[model samples]
Target: MGDPVTDPAPDGIDEGRRLIRLGGDKGLSLADRLAERFHRLTWRTPLHTLRLKGRYPLKLIAVPEDPILGDIARGTMLLEGVLSFRGEARDIETLDLSKPHPKPFAEYLQSFAWLRDLSTVATRARGAPIAEYLMGLWLTAHADTQGGIAWRPDMWGRRILAWTAHAPLILSSSDQIYRSKVLNALAKGALHLDRTADKAPAGAPRIAAWCGVVAAGLLIPGGEPRQAFGEAGLLRALGTGLFDDGGSVSRSPAMLLDSIQLLTLLQESYAARSAELPETVAVTLTRMVAALLGVAHADRGLSSWQGGGPASETQVAAVIEASGVRTRPLRQARDWGYQRLAAGTAVLIVDAAPPPIARL
Candidate 1:
């Protein structure tokens, strides 16, 4: 009813408009800056682009002409509002490190853990940053609460907590205090899984696999701690759970690419710290990449597989670059998951599968 706050904030508005324009240039045809802000805040990347390498038909999931951009913008706004000032909010009170948290607070902390994963991909969303702060707050507040953050019953919540296991190992290395909290939370989470295995859903194996991954990641940082149990479980789960013949356990093409992206991050994290990734881990990863190349459409971008994926070839290129391994180019003659490189084009995706699986 009143003038929109976005009508002011010259820098924010201009930046928002520029981001919207960039999306438009890529063919999203956003109607206005407000719409663009919505897309930036929520979708993170264009949904149309996310459809790359996906198998699900986009038309079925399309919202009414209104689009999802509005939700993104609102989320972004919340982030800016919260972060406008530094340390204005009071420090969270210390909690008893030895006890379990109350149910509601524990649930919120679990959600906060999940938000960190969501925020990683939602970089452009205003909600992205807000989600980050909420996650940090939840962790800070609940670390000492009764039950340190544990797995929630919901699938999405479990996925979020599972993913957060990597961040502390990778990003919190310098912050021993934070890192220690992460270790405690991870152990608590694993313990909860162990206690409730019988009550877990049929798909709980996936979550178990991730718990192993988190353990593996943590071990890498703690001076390659000789935790035989955790390390063995991680290797087993990654080998068995993360991949399928087509590439990823989750058939969502977007998810497959995301897995690759995460692997690249993990690989780089280890390399940056001068730690060695296990040989079995490296071999499995290479096999995964080869399988991905097998399915990649001719343009060097993955064809839409099941759900959604990145449209840009840039993502795949980044993965390849990070891998530090030379990928064999797709052959023009075969035409199955093959990319043909002519004089001008650096890469092109064609549906040509690679010749037979080679032993790693």
Candidate 2:
């Protein structure tokens, strides 16, 4: 991998990370950052926290399957008390939530997306017990607490979807009290998402935050209001995050893939409840999948662009399979700015769009 710094220009998101670490980020003024940090400070008050603690639905109205598959081998390692993400692993046999970790690893843990992967291999080993223990620790530590990485909207959203998607795996136990606690935690998470999904960092993070809101609304009883709010936010995000041709505003293949997978999970969640898919969500999925195929090589993998690597064929196939979008490969994607041309046995994929922007 070439350093985005020296091998090529760094991506805007990477640059943003650099600026944030230096406290020189231009996206948010100090006041803006502080305001974002405290938009719903009332949620964190001890009285409000106690009110949430007092009651919760004892069970989800339904359980939804996450179409994305988890790595069996990674799930096995997770059962062994370790989790690895972006080349960083933590021995979480017993992790302290207050302790700091590298950013990517921290987000990975807080997202609880691992629960999906672990669900796949959990029945074979002690996956259920391990999941319950770790989740209990998280609940104990962060109950109704706000701020920090754990409460970041994207991670919060992912965690809600994860908890809801694999409720059987994560909430499985004979202990009624523990079961109630997990259910209450899910309600609390959904409430937080309801109030703060828009506060997530823009682009994919914003999309992710909204995904959680929709998923919770769909699976939890009497969540019609959240579902409606989330769908509206998602529609607004689409106008900015996607071109008419459905390429990501970031112009990264990786981001496109992530968007497909995230939305697909939410789509399937809607399906599980036998509900009508929202028309805009349906339309966006179709266009994004077609745009993804346009960028794929004849062999079914994507070209690297905007600091994204050429994604693996297996990963791409899984996303498409899960998406269930049958739109043909895009030949000429306008505004998305890619053109696929072939003659004889030769193939050409052109980068027809403007250079990728860092902070779309």
Candidate 3:
């Protein structure tokens, strides 16, 4: 997907390319890698680890509902040890946390977000043990390694959301020690997210990180302070990471989908608590749904625009349904970055904005 300039018109896409040249929505640079290495080393110090030892919400105030629906077939596949996330599929047997992997798949594995999918299985009794087993494996591998990928701010955030929303599945084991490990892991993750969420890269990753923080705050007993802290960060992220028009800063349809999905998971926490939805969150969802619909074709599949591919209708519909926001597709975008036109069976979508800046 080149920069979205026009819908196959004679007009060239130099404007989008010019924007890309200004920064890096294209790929991470050497500076990004070096700074991350230094930061990782610095953050992994003994003192840092000690600070991370703060209160682990040892028990849940309540189990959250998993709003994003999972496919029964996919859930069964996850039981068979094949994991899928955001269209990325890889064998669980082949997963290696110590080695490099695709960003999407690694996020899926490290975060254990697949629990959302596995929960869709008709027989919870059949899948609970496997979920427990996976949790055990995660603990054994990354429990003590705070510097590892599993402890990445966004990964921790994602894990917190998963473990909390689908708590019943992972917490199904009656083994006291196993239960302790699970709770301890959740505590560690929430604490880690608290410390590092602000440092998460802007856009979908930051949203995921903050969503985890909020999830922990809501479900963890005595987590009011953390909840407050997380909501502040989330609001800040939304302010910067999205255009007022509800489009993602990244201008990628995929990013919009991810933001919706992450926020929907957070809404589950809100619902479980019977808490009022934050006004900002409510508004953001409304705007985002409108913007997302701008790129959605008549078939309800997302049209590829600005370095993204057309997402399957099933996936798009699932995210929209899970969002529970009824909004019409936007006809025009404001930093949300697209223009839509429709006439009977004809529809044309144009990318009217530059790519997202690197810092975003």
Judging by lDDT against the true structure, name the best candidate.
3
Model 1 residue 34 distance off true place after TM-score fit, in angstroms: 48
- Candidate 1, 181-267: lDDT as tens digits: 544554444343332322222122433434334333333333234234444644655543443232444334455555554454445
What TM-score would every model get versus the actual structure? 0.44, 0.84, 0.86
lDDT of each: 0.39, 0.75, 0.78
Q: Which sequence of candidate numbers ranks them by lDDT, best first?
A: 3, 2, 1
Better candidate number, 1 or 3, judged by lDDT: 3
Measured on C-alpha atoms, candidate 1 has an lDDT of 0.39
Q: Write the per-residue lDDT of candidate 2 for residues 1-360, one digit (tens) a residue.
A: 732221111112222322111112245567977897567565567755554443467788778878878877778788788887778877887578778889877887888878877877777236778788888878877865766788777887888878878777777798998898888888887777777778876667888889988888888888888788889988877766777667787777788888888888888788889975688777778888877877888678877887787887877998888877776666666566677786765668887655655344
Across residues 90-182, which tens digit of lDDT does each residue of candidate 3 receive? 676765556766876777788777787788874679878878877777787788777767778888888888888877888878798888888
